[model samples]
Target: MNLTVVGLGLIGGSLAKDLRSKGIAKHIIGVDKNPDHCNKAKELGIIDEFQPLDKAVANADLVIVSVPVNATLKVLTMVLDLIDDKTVVMDVGSTKSEICKVVENHPRRKNYVANHPIAGTEYSGPVAAIEGLYDKKTTIICDQDKSDPKAVLLIKVLHEAIGMHVIHMEAEEHDRHIAYVSHLSHVISYVLGKTVLEIEKDETNIFELAGSGFASTARLAKSNPDMWTPIFMQNKKSLLKAVDEYQKNLQEFRDLIAGDDEKALYNEIGRINDIRRVLEGLALKRAQGN
Candidate 1:
């Protein structure tokens, strides 16, 4: 298969590397607006060749787009002009509702599969991509029923081959769930990092006092702001709702601490602990393939 990965950033580069490593695609090509990214992707062996968008899509059996949320619709519009009925186009953007709505009425919408693989790190660029990055990850396929059956099946098979478990979801539902889980986490991390930097202006010595808890919580702050800014904007309504809820929870905890309500604080912490238990159970289930 001739596969073309557009953007050549973290997700796109990772996909190209995995597809090539697994021998799933005979020829893997890459497309990127940034010449540096193209050169780096080629050097990293992520793709066999780098070409212009038109030529890449024209010759591709599968086209995987991994760009920012705001850029997704535009890229899809351009790809649609070049792709044929047999070509399978998939996008790995964080936000899906807007993109899905934009392409809903397009004549060749069946060739497009909207996918969000729940995997990534606080990094970007082709150099940051690693093999097996998508392995054991849960990939959400939004509005699969709206896509062509063969195209959807091919995408599912590809994701499975790359060690991802597929889950079907409506675009709106995916946005809502990810807002709380993924988007809200990034918001909190960014704010926390800002707060800490304000207090400890000395970046060199701040790490001496920072423990594992702080390190873990602030890890997402290192993520690419360019990518996240558009995602937060695209899902503004859902993200705002999530932030409001988080603020309310934080205020409640503050009030408990102020009043020295030991029992209430303990109970609240215990309830959250239950969430950890639930997550641990889910992890175990996934490991056992249950």
Candidate 2:
């Protein structure tokens, strides 16, 4: 298959590199509005060549759109007119409902498979691409029933070949779950970073004191704002709900600390400990390929 990867950022560049490394595509072409990304993707051998969007989609058997959530609709709109019946188009945007809705009535809707791969690091751009990033990750396919069987199967096969576990869900359900698990975490991390930076204004070496727990919790703060801002905006309702719940939890903790309520603090800490145990189990299950 000849694959064309749009955007050529962390996800797109990584996908292109993996496809070539695994011999999954006969030729891989990349498209990016950023000339620097185009040059870097080629220099790093992430793509066989870089071409204009029209030419790349014209020749590709598969097209992967891995741009920002806001930019996805515009890019898809531009390419929907050019995709052939045999070409399978898939996007890896963070939010799905809006993008799915935009392309729902298109004649080529059947050729487009909407997917969200549940894996990434707090990095961006072609330079951040890494191998094995998608291995053992859960890939959520929304509204699979609405997509053409052939296109769906092709995408399922492609993700599975790269060691991803495929699961299907409604777009609304995917958005809700991700708002809590993914989007909320990023928000917390960003706020935590801001909070710490505020206190560290005079303590230049405070970051040096940060250990594993702080590092783990604040890791998402390094994510690209350009990419994430649109996602937070697109999924505003769900994300706002998550943020409200998070604020309530934080307020409860603050009250416990303020009142020096030992029992309440202990109980709250125990509840969070249970969450740690659940995450540990998930990590183990993923490791064992359960």
Candidate 3:
């Protein structure tokens, strides 16, 4: 397939690399607002060449818009308008409901598919593109019934080629679930990093006090704000609810600690530890390339 990737950052560049390696993408044309990223992607062999959006979409069999959530809706609409009847367009934005709602009545709506690939590192740019980044990951295709069947099948084939499992659900449900599973984690990480930074005036002593646990928890805080800020805005309602629930749980823990309810605190910690089994299963699946 002749693929055109709209953003040559981590997600787009990574997809370009895997798709080419898997022989799913015959040639990739990159389109990025950043010329540096486009040049970097080409230098790294992530994309074959760089082209203007209009020209790229004109000849592409598939167009993947991997830009930020705020930019995705506008770019997707433009790409859909430019695409021919046979061409398929997909976006890998974090939020889905807003994008879906905006394009619900578009003339070429059927050509577009709303997708969220549950994969990434706490890194951005073409240099951070890993070869097997999407391996054994779950890609959610929201409102699949609204897209053309052939386009949906092509998207499924593309994700499967990179070792991802494809599932379908409503766009609203996808937004809600991801607000808790993905967005909430990032929020916690950002807040945790801010809290630590506020306390650690002596940066030199931070590393001495920190360990793997702190590093792991704060890793997502290093993610690009340009990307995350838009995601938080797009899914504001769901994200607020997630934040509210998280605050309630945090208060519960605070109350337990303040009231000297040692047994309650211990039991709560033990209960949360049950997530270990689920995480282990996920790790096993990824390791086995399921």
User: Whole-model Cα lDDT per candidate?
Assistant: 0.91, 0.91, 0.93
lDDT for position 47 in model 2: 88
Candidate 3 lDDT score relative to the true structure? 0.93
| All candidates: TM-score | 0.97, 0.97, 0.97
TM-score of 1: 0.97
Candidate 1 lDDT by residue in tens digits, 18-52: 88888998898889999999998888888889999
Mark the 10 consecutive residues where model 2 has the least summed lDDT: 13-22
Error of 2 at 92 (Å): 0.3
Model 2 per-residue lDDT tens digits across residues 1-290: 99999999999888887777788988989999999999999999898899999999997899999999999999987777888898889999889999999998999999999999888889999999998898888898999988999899999999888888999999999999899999999999999999999999988999899999999999999998989999999999999999999999999899999999999899889988888788998899789765
Pairs clashing in candidate 1?
Answer: none
Worst 10 residues of 3 by lDDT: 198-207
Among residues 3 or more apart in sequence or in different chains, the pairs in candidate 2 whose N, CA or C atoms overlap within 3 Å are none
Flag regions of model 2 displaced more than 4 Å: none
